[model samples]
Target chain A: MSILEFSNVSFSNEGKSILKNLNIRIESRDYISIVGPSGSGKSTFLKLCNNLISPSEGNISFNNKNVSEYNPIELRKEIAYCFQMPHLFGDTVMDNLSFPFKIRNKKVDMDRIKYLFSLFSMDEEFIDEKVLNLSGGEKQRIALMRTLMFTPEVLLLDEVTSALDSENTLIVENIINKLNNEGSTVLWVTHNDEQSIKYANKLLTLENGEIKSLEVLK
Target chain B: MNSGATLSTSSLIIASSLVLISLFFSYYQKLNLEKETIIGVIRAIVQLTIVGYLLNFIFGLKNPFFTTLLLLFMTTNASFNASKRGKGIKNGFLISFIAIGIGAFITLFILVVSGAIKYEPYQIIPIGGMIISNAMVAIGLCYKQLLSNFKNKREEVETKLALGADILPSSIEIIRDAIKTGMLPTIDSMKTLGIVALPGMMTGLILAGTSPIEAVKFQILVTFMMLSTTSIASFLACYLAYKGFFNGRKQLI
Candidate 1:
């Protein structure tokens, strides 16, 4: 079943088109990697999936319902987006992690939080560390973990590991691959060809805000 | 009981010499302020003279209609100026007007009801002007800080939004910061009330021959009034201005 679908969608900003005539169906648990040059609307396309950027024409549907019909707050919870540069809020790592629950008026689950920390190969003690003092890779890892705390149906990643070293990149890649295997649909935008081919079950090549080709990778 | 004598024509002319002295210094230092200083001095003289006559006429009339109209004029001008700080937000003028109005009305209402100030031209007009002007500054700060914070921290806010957080919860920190920025000036001034500087109200009262202790009491009331004015204005402005950052679709504009 298709988890997400976009039909004849075109998004424009300030009289210029960002993504034009995008028609794609993302099946449940599909791992799709998008690759394109810098101005090709790669990030914008991912943003459209989460309804961050609405289309100028046509419609995007999530779960067979028009994306516009869904309340953005509820839609966003189901379709989470992680940016290339992790934007962490609050002082401590725990603060960032607990935000998902905090908004819902629920208490933080320390055991689950510890488990997520371990999943990112970080010790439980790191939760109390100030976000400002964390290294780049640690910040990215924590950001990704915070997004995962809600367990959304779809995960949209925009070059989340671009700034990480090779070792850190491998760790992120492994975690994402694990998430995909566990049945969450993942759409990742990457500039690196190797990472695109390695993780994606299907590789989508985008050019000039349009998908040039879709190829089966696995 | 006022100790200071009224300035005579020659005394006024002697004070006018201070402007000439400033003009001479500007010329000697090669500063371009000679023209600006001359124009500014002339403008101040003319404007103050006009306001003095106007106030005299209005106070003598003692009509509530004229008094209310004057207050409205002052508020309109103040809110218009305050709106400039919120250029990014739509309906900046209306938001400022409402915020400043609420702050001023509440504070002045309390003053009148408590019998601290009578609802007359002299008491209401001056006191209302001070309250409105301070509220205007606070609301302006709130608008400026809120818009800038939302712009700079877009990703941080959107990240929270993506996590199913409502708009209010998502931008809570920035909102808090904006309100803090608005309240900071009054808070700092209150902290150093007499030590750092003697405020205008106290100085004016002292010069008017009010006893020092009585002047102190009025100064304290002014400080408290300003504290109430600033905080209320900032909170109202922040609440109204934040909605402009997000659209109906819940996306940050």
Candidate 2:
């Protein structure tokens, strides 16, 4: 089933087109990477999917329903977006991890949280430590764990591993690859061609507000 | 006991000197003063003259109705100013009203119930002035900080939303920072109250024939009240103002 689709989508800011006549589709469990040079509208495209910015011209549908008709909050729950720079809140790591569930009025899932912590090789004691004291790698790991806690149907990763070191990058990649394999539709945006080729089941290359090519992974 | 005319002349001279000195400093610092200075001076003259006359009337009227009306006027005006200062914030008026109303009410209640002051017009007026003014500053600062934080950290905020977090907790970091920054000025003033400066309450009491010790005691109360009011106002304002930035659908507007 097609979980996400963008048709004839065009976006403009201050009278300039940032994305023009762009179209794309993602099926269930498809691990797709969007590659582009800097300022190629990659981030903007991802934001459009999440309804952070509405399209100036075009239509987006999720699960075959027009995205414009869905409540933005509901849309966000379906398609989660991760930023290049992870922003963690609260004084303690546990506070950061549990914030999402608490805000939604859902009970905290300790078992799932613990499993995720172990996956990232984070100790249980780190949960009590303040997020302010965590290094960049640790912050990214926590951010990723928090996002996956609710298991959204689609994950929009906006160069989330760009700021991490090689070791942390590998850890994140392995985790995301595992999720993709387990039937999560992933739309990742990155500037690294090598990373795109290594992890992406399909590739969509963008340049100057347009899709240059779309190809299946060999 | 001396000539009223002489005292009035001295007061005018002191006020004029203060205005001139402030203008000179603003000019020397190259502050943006083209229209603001003129407007500020006019506003000062008009507001002070009106307040002077109003205070004189209240001192003699001794009517609770009139005194309560004056309190309402002060709170309304302060709330309006706060709302205006926090432009681009949706439902700002509601937030401002709550912040100013709650802060002023709680402080006034403490003063009256504790018998620290009598339930007279004069007492109510000054206490209301202090609480409302401080709350106005607090709300204004909080709104500014929250908006700027949202602008600069857009990416981070979105990341949290994507992670299955709702808008409130997703923006909690920014809101907390805003509240802290908003209350900073009040906190600093409290820390420097006696060492660096004498606040208006202390100075006014001294000029009105109170002993230095008595004036200091009153100053301490006012300072403490301001701290309490400012903290509450900023916290409430930040929490409420954050709602304006995001729609009910959890999308940033």
Candidate 3:
């Protein structure tokens, strides 16, 4: 079953067409990369998927259900989005990671948090450190870990590694590849062709608010 | 008669010096605050003069109702000033009212019940002034912080919402941080009160013929009252402001 589907989606802000006649689909476990220039509506597309922005026209369905029919908050749990610039709250790293669980009233998965931290090569001691004191790389890792805590069925990554150094970028890219291999549905947006080629199982190229090309990678 | 004459002359000298010094600082320092300084100095002089006469009458009458009315007027005006400073905040007046009302009442009741302040107009007026002024500062700071946090961390807030967090929890940190930042000025003032500067209450008490030790004691009491009132007001204002930032369904406005 297609986990996510966008059919003839159109969006405009202030009567200016930001997205027009865009269509795409994500099968279960598919790692899709959306490549486009800045203002090509890549972020807008992700936002629509996450219901941050409603489409101006056309329909979006998730798991064969109309996107509008699902509660945005519930839909968000199933489909988490990572922003381009990670913003951590004025709290400890542990608080940042456990916020999703705390909000939902779920038990803190300490093991999973530890595992994610180890995977990102972060120190366990960082859990007690204030988020304000964290380096950029540490913040990005903590932000990703926070999003992943809920184990969302699909992850919408919007330039998640764009602000990171090359070393940190590699760490994130490796994690993305691992997540994809482990059967997570990933929709990633980036202008970096190399990152797209590295992890994308399916590539969707957008231009002028429309998908110009769709290619399946081996 | 000699003491009275000395007090009057000293008051005039102090008032004039404050005005001249403020003007000189505004002009020579090129602080861009010349207009505000001039207006503030003029307003202070006029307002204090009026209040001085009013206080003479009130002290003579010493009626509880009039004192209560005066307290209410001060709280309401302070709350109004707070709301004005918190522009772009919806229903800010309501938030300020709740903040000032809760903060002032709690602190004043405690002070009165503890016998720190008598139930008379003299004690109530000064105590009310302390509470209301701090509450005003607290509300203003909390509102400013909340607005700035919302502006800077908007995406993070949206991200939380998209991650199944409700509006309240999503905004809890912002509100908490804002309140903390808002309370910092009050905390700093308390810390620097005697060593760095003599607070208005202490200075006023001393000028009114109270001994230094007595003036210091009153200042300490007022500081404690201000701290408690400001904290309560800031917390209430922040919580109320958060509600205004959302819709009926708790979605961000």
Per DockQ, the best of the predicted structures is: 1
The candidates, ranked best first by DockQ, are 1, 2, 3
> Global lDDT for candidate 3?
0.85
Worst 10 residues of 1 chain A by lDDT: A114-123
Q: Per-prediction TM-score of chain B?
A: 0.95, 0.86, 0.87
Report the candidate with higher TM-score, 1 versus 3: 1
The residue-by-residue lDDT of candidate 3 on B1-253, one tens digit each, is 0024145677777668767787788799898897998898789879998999998789778999999899889988998999999997888888898889889999989988998888788778877887898899889988888888888888878878867787888898898898897788889998888889899877877776788998888888888888899899999999888877765434465
- A1-218 in candidate 1: lDDT tens per residue? 99999999999999999888999999999999999889999988988899876889999999999999999988998899998889888989989999888877888888889888777777889889999999888888888898998788899998889778998789889989998998889999998889998978999889999989989888
TM-score of 1: 0.93
Candidate 2: the clashing residue pairs are none
Give the per-residue lDDT of model 3 (tens digit) for A1-218. Answer: 79999899999988999999977878999999899888888888988887877888999999999988887778888899988788787579887888887888889989988898898887899999998898887787888888888677899998888778899899888988888788779999987889997878899988999999989996
* Candidate 2 lDDT score relative to the true structure: 0.83
Error of 2 at B122 (Å): 2.6
RMSD of 2: 4.5
Task: Give each prediction's root-mean-square deviation over alpha carbons.
Answer: 2.3, 4.5, 4.8
User: Where's the lowest-lDDT run of ten residues in candidate 3 chain A?
Assistant: A82-91
Give per-model TM-scores: 0.93, 0.81, 0.78
